[model samples]
Target: MKDGKRFPVVEENYRFECTLCGNCCTGDQRVWLNPADLMRMALFLGYGHTSELFRQNVVLLDEGENGAWRPRILFKSYKKLRFCPFLENHLDDRGRITGLCRLHPKYKPLICRLAPLGRVWDAETGSEQWLFVKPAPDCPGVNSSRLNSLRETLQQYGSEIEEETAFLKKLQHFLEMKSEPEAYQELFYFIVKRKGEGDKR
Candidate 1:
């Protein structure tokens, strides 16, 4: 049952928990970094600015409307399997993954804090919404205190959540309009024109 305070508790029984399995941090998961995340990562790495770090490590995935570009950092891999560049699989003398991140805790991205949670937009209203997902089937924290922790983390980054929601809405709108090229071109022009007007202010 949802605490019924922060997020709308859906039919699915939700809980908070992380087993430190590191499964969520690895693989082809779309790890999109935002401006705030870039700043945090740079500060953590003792770099004066994120520009240098971004220029060297990030690759542009796609171009969005108004010249916005989506970039992702490449991960280092030993063999065919790719891991999160910030993840360290080694254990201490006690043999624990320890949930330690190579990037400073402050620098971790919005997605990092909101793991097991996803954002979507309602087609009818064009409003954004959030949904929680189980990190893994084997995760013991599926319906426990871990859920609460995740919610708290999300609350702390409320602004980022809203921004993400807006981005999702725009992306969805773009995709839906793509099927109608003429309509899409018109809409794109309208948005660009409005953005240009806003920049003048």
Candidate 2:
């Protein structure tokens, strides 16, 4: 999708409360992670280092040549349903809906925290625009009135958004370089590389 694509915001505000339906967390999409996400999850899980999650299958390693590697939250499945490894059926138990994110509140990936709302960073404009991607197959939470607290929800993750935006800015700069061999490892680590946990959902 193009950046700044217009989306219908309800009553002049975005309306979306993740019902923990797990639809956003599932499907063929992978939950890409950044160093900030890894550090949060690691600390939350009581791991001294981020690498520890790699060994436990909590996070998957995408090692580019050398020691250059990035971490991703590998997808896991229950029966035939696929989702982020950290998503669990907790908060609610209705229909196909599950509970909540295991790493929520703080360690949740930025992507998950900003569900329903999509964002694209425009380097040319030097700004990031929030958007609403086409809704998932049929997610009820997207239009739920409970999604009224856009500012408050975002406020809770102010530091995280800053960290994410800063990380993206750096990555964008490195990607623009003719060749990033000198900073190849660091650049690769900063980029959110995708690694499929499986072929099926």
Whose lDDT is greatest here?
2
Model 1 segments beyond 4 Å from truth?
1-13, 58-69, 92-94, 122-126, 136-140, 143-154, 163-201
Predicted structure with the largest TM-score when compared to the true one? 2
Count clashes in each candidate, considering only residues at least 3 apart in sequence or on different chains. Answer: 5, 4
What's the lDDT for candidate 1? 0.56
Q: How many residue pairs of model 2 clash at the backbone?
A: 4
Show model 2 residue runs off by greater than 4 Å: 1-12, 55-57, 60-71, 77-80, 90-97, 147-149, 178-201
Model 1 reaches what TM-score against the true structure? 0.61
Which 10-residue window in model 1 sums to the lowest lDDT? 186-195
Candidate 1: the clashing residue pairs are 15-143, 16-146, 16-147, 17-141, 17-146
**lDDT (10s digit) by residue, model 2, range 1-201:** 334335643223566666566667677665667778877777688766556677788877554322334456878877987777776765343445475777877667787677766666666786766676534667878667764565775687788888877776665665566334455345323322234433322
Q: In model 1, what lDDT does residue 178 have?
A: 56
Candidate models: Cα lDDT each? 0.56, 0.63
Each candidate's root-mean-square deviation in Å? 8.5, 9.0
